[model samples]
Target chain A: MRRSLFPRLGLLLGLLFLWLPVLLLAGYAFSDARIPFQWGGFSWRWFVALAGNERLLAAAWLSLRVAASAATLAVVLGGCIGWVLARQGPFRGRPLFGALAGAPLVLPDVVTGLSLLLFFVLLEGATGWPAERGATTILLAHATIGGAYAAVLVQARLATLERELEEAARDLGAGPATTFATITLPLLAPSLVAGWLLAFTLSLDDVVVASFVSGPAGTTLPMVVFSMLRLGLTPEINALAVVILLLALTSAGGALLLLRGVLGRR
Target chain B: MSRPLLSLRGLSRRFGETVALDRLDLDVPPGEFLALLGGSGSGKSTLLRVIAGFEAPDAGQVLFEGRDLAGVPPHARPLNMMFQSYALFPHLTVAGNVAYGLRREGVARAERHRRVAEALAMVGLEEFGRRLPHRLSGGQRQRVALARVLVKRPRLLLLDEPLGALDAGLRERTGFELRALQRETGAAFIMVTHDQSEALALADRVAVLEQGRLVQLGPPRAVYERPATRFVASFLGGANVLEGRPDGAGGLDCPLLGGTLRPAETLPEGCTACALRPERIALRSGASGPNTASGTIEEVAFRGDDSLLLVRMPGGAVLRVGHAEEDGAPPPRGSTVQLSWEAAAVVPLLG
Candidate 1:
C-alpha cells in the first residue's frame, strides 16, 4: 500500500529488537525490585523469591534433569539417526556419515564443549563409565550437541518421506517392528515433536555445553543464568529469565500446535 | 488347485546392466485378475515388485501359495500393494488407512472395526472413514487405496498403476471399480499397467512386457487378435500391414488390391506381413475386386466417430483405413481411390 507501510515498519522494528529483551525479562518478573533499573514497583518479588530459591531450585532441578534427559535422548537417538539418514543410500561412509552427522553443526560450541569434555575424560580413564562429570555428563553432553539439532531437523523431515510409504508398510503386513511402530511412528509425528522440542530447546539453552561437561552436580539452567549474569542484572536474574521464558514459550507453543497438526494433516 | 495363487518360477532381475526381470514367468491364478501389460521399461513394475514381496528376484521362484518366496520379506507377504502412489498412509485417517492392513492382519479390535467397516463399504467410501488422505479426492485417494487393499483380505492384490492416477473420468469409473474389486474380493489381483485401455479393461490374463521379456502371454482377446511380435502389433492396436509371397487356399497369397491375399499360417517361405483391421478395408470404385486396388488419397484424419484414411497403396504402401463414413469418399488429397479387401480379411502379420 505505501510500500507496504515502510516494510511493515521495518518488520515491527525488527520484532521490537527481538522482543525487547524478552519484554524486559517479562517486566522484571513482577518487580518489587532488588533494585532493578528503577521501577521498584509491582511485587511478586522475584515470583516470591523464586519459590524459596534453594540454589535456584538446584539449578532448576539441573535444568529439568538435563532437559528431560536431553529431550528423551534426543528423541530416541535423533529418531534412529533420522531414520538411518533417510533410508540409507549414498553408500560407503556416505561422506563419512554426512560429516559425522553434521559435526554438531560446524563444531565450535567451544569446540563441541571441549571435545565432549575430552571424551568424558577419556571415557572415565577407559571404561570406569560415566563416573561423574555430573548430571550424567550433562546428559551425555547434551545428547551429543542436541542430537545434532535433532539430526538436522529430522534429516530435513526424512527428505519429504515416501520410501514408498515404507514399501507400503512392508507390503502391508508390517514387520520390522510393526513397520517402525505403526507406519514409521505415525509418519514421524511432526518431525518427532519438532525434534523433541529442538532437543528440549537445546538442553534448556545450554551455557556453552554446560561450560564444558559441567561438574559439582552439573549446574544447568544455562549454568544458573550464567552465574546470575556474572553477578549483575539480578531481579533474581529477571525471575529466572521469566521462568525460562515461560518454559520456552510453552514448548514453542506446543511445538507450533504440533506443527499445525502435522502440517495440517499432510 | 489353490497353489497357483502366484507362482513365477523363472523370474529374474539385474538392474546394474539393465535387465529388470528377464526369464520372468508368471501365474497368479487364485481369483485371477492378473494384468501386467507393458511399455515403459516393461517388467511391469518389476513384476509387481516381485509379486509384492517388495522385490528380490535375481533368479527364479516366488511361489507364494506353493510357498517359496525365499526370504519372504515384505511384511511376510500374504500380499497387498495398490501403490501407483496411492500409498495412502499420510498419517492415517480413512479409518486409519483402512485399519492399516487390518492391523497387520492380527485383526481383532472388533475384527479391526469390522474389516474397516467392510473395507469402507467396499470403496464407495462409507463416510470416508473420518477423512484424511489429504481429505480425499483423487477418486477419494483411489477409494482410499481401495480401502487399503480391501481391508487386508489379501491372498494377493498388488495393483501398482491401478487406474494410473485416475481421471479420464476417474479412469472410467475406476475400470469398473477395479473389475468389481476383483470380483468382490475374490483376491489374486496382480495389476501393474502401462494402460492399453487399462490392459484391455481389467485383464483376465494379459502379461505382455518387452525389454524385460515375456513378449506375449494371452487372453485379452488373445493379446488383441493374435499379436505375438512386431512388438505385439504396435503395442496393441492399429494394425494394417500387407507384405508379399505365398499363394491362395489360405496360404501366403499376399496381393491384396485386386484380390488374392490370405497369408497367416506363420507366413514364411520368403515371407512378409499382412494384418488389416482398419474396418477390414472397403473403398471401391471400378471394383471387379479380387482384392481390388488403387491408391492416392494420402491423408485425411477426421476422428470423432471415426474417419482416418491415409491411403497411398498401389504398391507404394501406407494403408491405415478406418471409416464409419463421416461423409465417406471425401477422399480428396491426391484422390484416385479404390482400395478393397476380403481375401479372408487379411490379418497375417509378422514384420
Candidate 2:
C-alpha cells in the first residue's frame, strides 16, 4: 500500500510541477491590478486592453502568419525526408544524410540562430533575394529546425507501419506511385498532423531564433513579450499568455479528437 | 500437358552467405493447384516471391506464358499474391479493397462495382462490403484479401501461407473454402506452406523443399507413399525410417527390425534406408509371424479416431504403430507386443 501511495503521489507532484506555473499565470490574467501578480480582485479589464493594443495585435498576427507558413513548409520538407529514410532502402550517403537530417534537432538554439543569420546574409550577398531579414527569414529559420523535429516524428511513425500494406497494393496492380498515394499517404496522415502541430507550436513560442532573423519590421509576439519583460510585468501580458494557452489547449484537444475519431473507425 | 503456364528454371537467390533458393526448377500447368511444402527457412516463401516479382533471384529465368519476366515490375506482372498477413487496407472498406485493382486498370466505375460484388460474393463476403478490415473476423479478413486478388482476374495466384493465422478448426474450414474458390475461379495457384497435411489435402502436386533445394516433387499420394529421400520420409507424415543397406539378396538388413525387409518395389542403387508408415504396422498380442518383431509398448497416445502406440524393440529402436479405436482397446504401455507389416508397406528410401 505504501509503495502504491508513493507512485500516486509522485504522479500528482509531476503534474503540479508542470502545470502550476501556467495555472498561476492564468489566475493572474483575471486579476484587477496594475501589477501583474498583485491580486486586487477578479476582472476582465486586461483581456479587453489586450484586444485594443494595436502594436501587440499586429505582432500576434505576424507571429500567426509566420507559424502557419513555417509549419506547412516543415511538413512538406520533413515528410519527404522521413519517407526517403524509412522506405527508400540502403543507399550511398545514407548515414551522412541521416546525421544531417538530425543536426538541427541537437544543435543549441543560439548556434542554430547565429548560423542561420550568417547563411541569410551570405545568400543576400550572392543573390539579392530575401534582401533584409524579417518575417520571411524567421519563417525559413523556424521551418529548418521544425523540419528536423517533424522528420524524427514522421520517420518513427513510418517505421512502425506495415510494409505489407504497400506491397499488397502493388500486388493488386497499382503502380509504385499509385500504391504510395493510395496506401502510404493515407496511413501517414495522422503523423503529418501531429508533426504540423508540433512545428506550429515551436514556431509560435520561439523567441531566440526569431530575434536573430527578424529585422526592424519583423518583431513577433514572443519578441514583444520578451521586450515587455525587460521593462515591467503587466497584467495584459498575463492576459496574452492565458489566450495563447487556451488556443494551444483547444487545438491539442481537437487534434486528439480527430485522431481518435479516425483511428477508432479502424 | 499443353504449354506450361509458369516455368521457373535455375532459380537461385542468396542473402549474403545464406541461400534462400538453390537452382530450383518448377513448372505449373494452367489451372493447376500446386503447393510448395517445407519447414522454416526451406525457401518455399522465397520461391513464391520470385514468381510474384517481389524478390529477384540471383540467377534464374521466370517464364510466364513463355515470356521471360526478366525486367517486369511487380505491378506489371500478370499474377497476384495473397500475402500471409492478408495485408488488407485498414482504411478501405471491403468493397473498396476489392475494387482497387480494377480501378487501377482503368475499369469503368460501373463495371468495377459489378466485378467487386461478384468477387465478394464468391468469397461469401457480399454483405461485408461496407465494413473495414479491422472490424471483421480474421477469417473474414482472409476472404477479403482473396476477393481483392480474385477481382484482378490474374492467370496465376500465389498464396503465401494462406491459413497460417487461423486456429485449427477455422484453418481447416477456411482451407476447404479456399480450395473450392480456386476451382471456381479456375486460376493456376502456387501456395507456400509448411503444413504437409494441408499440402496433401489441397494441392494437385506437392513440392517438398529442404535447405533451399527441391527434395521431392510429385502428386500428393506419390510423394507421400514413395518418398525418395530420408528427409521426405520423416517430414511428410512422421514415418518411421529404418537405416539399412541392401543385402544383395533382394532384402534390406535393417538392425532396427532385427531381420531383413523385402519391400515390394526394386530398391534403387545404393539405397540405404526404408520408411514404414505408422498405420501400416499392425500390433498383435502373442506369437510373431513373417515380417514381425517383438517389442515392449513404451507409450500410447489417443488421437480422436485412433491411438498411436510407441513400441520399443530390444535394440532400443522405437517404432510407431497406429491402432484404431474400433480395433479394440490399445495395448497398454510396458506390455509385450508384436509389430508386423506387409512387404508392400515398407517403402525403400535412398540416402
Candidate 3:
C-alpha cells in the first residue's frame, strides 16, 4: 500500500503540474476583470471581445492556412525522401543524404530559423523570386522542418515493412510505379497520416521560425500571442488561449477518430 | 524436349568475395516440375531468382521461348514466385490478393472476379475469399499465395521452399495438394528446397547443387541411387563412402573395407571411392559373397520399420548396416557378423 501511494502521488502531481496553467487561463478567460489572476466576476464579454479582434482573427486564419499547406507538402516530399533513404540501396552520396535528412532533428530551432532567413535573403537578391518575406517564406520554412519530422517518422515505419510484399507485387505483374501505388502507399498510409498531424501541430505551435521569416504585415497567431503577453497580461489574451486550446483539442480528437476509422478498415 | 521452355546459358552471379552462382547452365521444359535441391547458400535460391528476373546474372543469358530476357523486368516476365513466407498482403482479402495480379495487368473487373473465384476454388479456398490473410491458418495462407500466383496463369512458377513454413503433417498434405495442382494447371514449376525427401517426392527431376555448382541433375531415383559426387551421395541420404583406389581391373582396392571389391559399373580411370547405401548391405552369420566384410556388431537401433546395426570392421572403421524388422532379430551387439552387398549397389564416386 505504501509503495503504491508514492507512484499514485507522482501521477497526480504530474497531471496537476501540466494542467494547472491551462486551468488558470480558462478561469481568467471567463473573468469580468481586465487584469489577469484577479477574478472580479464571471462574464462572457472577453470571448466576445476576442471575436471582434480583426488582427487576431486574421493571424489565426493565416496560421491555419500555413499549417495545412505545410503539412500537405511535408507528407508528399518527406514521404519520397523517406522511401529513397529506406529502399534505395547503397547509392552514391547516401551517407550525405542521410545526414541532411537528420539535420533538422538535432539542429536548434533558432539556428534553423536564422539559416532560413539568410537563405531567403540570398535567394531574393539573386533570383528576385520571393520578393518579400511573408506567408510564403514562413510556409517554406515550416515545410522544411516539418518535412524532416515527417521523413523520420516515415523512414522508421518503412523499416518495419516486409520487403517481400513489394517483391510479391512485382512478381504479380506490377511495375515499379504500380507497386508503389498499390502496395507501398497503402501500407504507409497510417504513418503518413500520423506524420502529417505531427507536422501540422508543430507548425501551429512554432513561433521562433515564423518570427524570423514572417513579414511585418503577416504576423501569425503565436507571434500575436507572444507580443500580447510581453506587453502585459489581459483577459482577452486568456480568452484567446482558451479558444486555441479548444480548437487544438477538438482537432486532435477528430484526427484520432479519423485514424481509427481509416486504420481499422485494414 | 519441347524446345526447352526456359534455358539458362552459363549463368553466373557473384557477391563480392563469394560466388552465388558459378557458370551454371540449366533447362526446364514446358509443364515440367523441377526441384533445385541444395543446402543453405548453395545457389539454389539464386538460380530461381535469376530465372524470375529478380537477380540479374553477371554473365549469361536467360532465354524464355528462345528470346533473351536481358532487360526484362520481373513484372514483365511470364513468371510468378511463391515466397517462402507466402508473402500475402495483410491488408487484402484472399480474393483481393488473388486478384491483384490480374488487376495489375489491367484486366476488366468482371473477368478479374471470375478468375479470382476460379483460383480460390482451385486451392480449395472458395469460402475463404472474404477473409484476410492474418485470419487464416498457416496452410490456408500458403494456399492463398499459391492461388495468387496461379491466377496470373504464368508460364513458369518459382516456389522458394514452398512447404518450409508448414508443420510436418501439414507439409505432407500440402505436398500432395501442390503436386496435384501442378498437374492440373500444366505450368512448369521450379521449386527450391533443401529437404531431400520433399524434393524427391514432388519433383519429376531433381537438380542437386553444391557450392554454387550443379553437382547432378536427373530423375529423383537416378540422383538418389546413382549420385555423381561424394557431396551428393551424403546429402541425399545415408551412404557409407569408402576411400579406395582402382585395382586396374573391375574392382577397387579399399583400405576401409579391408579388401578389393568389384564395382557395379566399370570404374573410370582414377576413380577414388565407392559409395554404398547402408540398407543395401546384408548381414549374415558367415562370409558369403565377393564383397564381404566380417565385423562385430557395435550397436543396434530399432526404427519401427527397420533396425540399423553398426558393424565395426577389423580396421577400426564402423559401417552402418540396415536390416528390415521382418528379416529376423538383429544380431546381438558385440556378436560377430559378416556384412555383404551386391556389386551393382556400389557407385563409383570420382572425386
Candidate 4:
C-alpha cells in the first residue's frame, strides 16, 4: 500500500493540473456572473446568450466546415505520400521525397504559416487565381500542415505492415489498383480514421496559421474566441468553450472506440 | 514427348555486383512436383520468384506453354505463390481470402462461394469460413493460404519454403498433404527449400543449386547415391571424401586412406577425389577383404536402428562407418577393427 501511494498521488496531481482550469471554465459557464472568478448564482442564461450570438454560431459552423474539408484533403494526399514512402523500394529521389514530407513536422507552425501566406501572395500576384483570401486560404494552410501529420502517422503504420500481404494479393490475381482498394485500404482503415481525427482536431484548434491566412469573411471559432478574450472574458465565451470542449471530447472518444473495435477484432 | 508446361531459357539476374541467378536453363513439365534444393544464397528463392513473374530476369526469357512471359505482370500470369509467411489477409475471413482470386477472375458470386467452400473443404477448413486469420493456428493459417491459392486453379504453383514455418510433426504431415493435394489437383508445383530432406521427400525430381547455378538436377535417389561433385556429396549427407592422385591402374593413391583405393568406374586422367557413403563401409573382425583398412574405433554413436562407428586409421584420418544395430555389438572404442567397402560404392568426383 505504501509503495503504491506515491504513484497514485502523482497521477491525481497530474490530472488535476491538466484539468483544473478547464473545470473552472466549465463552472463559469453555468454561473450567471459576467466577470470570471466570482459566481453570481447557478443559472443557464449564458447558454441562452451563446445561442443568440449569430456571429459566434457562424464562426463555429465555419470552423466545422474547414475541419472536415481539411481532414478529408489531408487523408487523400497524405495516404498517397505514405504509400509511396513506405512501399516503394529505394529510388532516385526517395531521400529527397522523405525529407520534404517530414519537413513540415519539424518546422514551427509560425514559420509554416508565414511561408504559406507568402506563397499565396506570390501565387495570386503571378496567376491571378484565388482572387481573395477567405475559406480557401484557411483550408489550404490547414491541409498543408494536417497532411504532414497524417503522412507521418500513416507511414509509421505502413512500415510495420507485412509486405507479403500485398505480394500475396498480386499473386492471387489482384492488379495494383485492386490490391490497393481491397487489401491495402481495408487494412489501413484504422490508421486512416485516426489520422483524419487528428487532422480534424488540429484544424479546429488552429490559431497561429489560421490568423495569418484567414481573411475578413473566414473568421473561424478559434479566431472569434481569441478576439473575444482580448476584449475581456465573458460567460458567453465560457459557454462556447464548453461546447467546443464537448465536441472535441466526443470526437476523440468516438475515434478511440472505433480504433479499439478495429484492433480488438484483429 | 509433349513440350514442357514452363521453360526458363538462359535466365539471369544480378543484384548490384552479386549474381542472384546465372544464365540458367530449366524446364517444368506438366503435373511434375519439382523441388529446388540449396543452401541460403544459392538462388533457389530467386529462381522461384522469376518463374512466378515477381522478378524479371536481367536477360533471357520465361516461357509458359511456348509463349514468352515478358511484359506480363505477376497478376496477369497464370500462376500463384504460397508465401513463406502464409500472408493471409488479417482483415478478411477464411472464406473471404479463399474467394479473393475467384472474385478477381470475374467469377459469379454464387460460383465464387461454391468454389471457396469446396476449396476450404479440400483443406479441411469447412467450418472455419467465418473465422479471421488471427483466430487460426499456424497450421490452420497455412491451410487457409493453400486454399486461397488452390481456389484460383492456376496452371502452376510456386511455394517458397512452404513447410519451413511449421513444427516438425506438422511439417511432416503437411508435406504428405501437399503431395496429395498436388496429385489431386494435377497442378505443377515448384517448391524452393533449403531442407534437403523436404526436397527428397516431396519432389519428383530435385534441382540442387550452388552459387546461383544448377549444380545437379535428377531424381533424388540418383542425386543422393551418385553426387556429381564434392559440394553435392557434403551438402546432401555425410560422405567420406578421400583426396589423392590417380595411380595409373584405375585406382587412386590416397594417402588419407593409407593405400590405393579402387573405384567402381575407371578414373579419368586427373581425378583427384572419390566420395564413399558412410553406410557403404562395413566393419569386419580381423583384416580380410579385397579393399580393407585396419583401424581402431575412435567413437561409437548409438542411433537406435543403426550405430555409427568412427574408425581412426594409421594415417590419422577418421573414417565414419554406419552399420545396422543387428550387426552385433559394435567394437568398443579403441578396439582394432578392419573396415571394408565394395569398389562399386566408391564414387569418383571431379574437382
Q: Output the number of the TM-score-best candidate.
A: 4
lDDT tens readout by residue for model 4, B147-252:
9999998779999999999999999999999999999999999999999999999999999998789889999999999888888887887788888888888888
Model 3 stretches with alpha carbons more than 4 Å out: A1-20, B288-290, B294-304, B307-318, B327-337
Candidate 2 DockQ vs. native = 0.62
State the displacement of the C-alpha of residue B216, model 1, in Å, after optimal TM-score superposition: 5.2
Winner of 2 and 3 under lDDT: 2
Query: What DockQ score does model 3 reach against the true complex?
Result: 0.60
> Can you tell me the CAPRI class of model 2?
medium
Instruction: For candidate 1, list the clashing residue pairs, or say none.
Output: B246-B252, B246-B253, B257-B291, B257-B292, B257-B293, B258-B291, B258-B292, B259-B290, B259-B291, B259-B292
Model 2 lDDT tens row, B236-343:
999999887688977787777676677887777888889999999887656354467888888999998999988888777888888988899997789988777888
- DockQ of every candidate: 0.27, 0.62, 0.60, 0.62
CAPRI quality band, candidate 1: acceptable
Q: Sort every candidate by TM-score, greatest first.
A: 4, 3, 2, 1
* Lowest-sum lDDT 10-residue window in model 3 chain A: A257-266
lDDT of each: 0.76, 0.90, 0.89, 0.89
Residue A152's lDDT within candidate 1 is: 77
lDDT of 3 by residue, B1-351 (tens): 379999999989998989999998899999999999999999999888888888999998999999999899999998889999988987788898999999989999999999999999999999998887888999999999999999989879999999999999999999999999999999999999999999999999999998788889999999999988899988888788888777787888877777666787788787888888889999765665458888888899999999998888887778889989889889899998887888998898966
State the fnat of candidate 3 relative to the true structure. 0.71
Candidate 2 chain B: 10-residue stretch with minimal lDDT: B283-292
**Chain B, per-candidate TM-score:** 0.40, 0.97, 0.96, 0.95
TM-score of 1: 0.36
lDDT of 1 by residue, B106-157 (tens): 7779978887888888877888687778876788887888788777787678
Q: How many pairs of residues collide in model 2?
A: 0
Q: C-alpha displacement of B105 in model 1, angstroms?
A: 31
lDDT string for model 2 (A1-266, tens) is: 44668889899999999999999999999999999989989999999999999888899999999999999999999998998898889999999999999999889899999999999999999998788889999999999988988898889999999988888888888888999899988888898998899899999999999999889989999999899888987899899889888888898999899887776664
lDDT score for residue B15 of model 4: 90
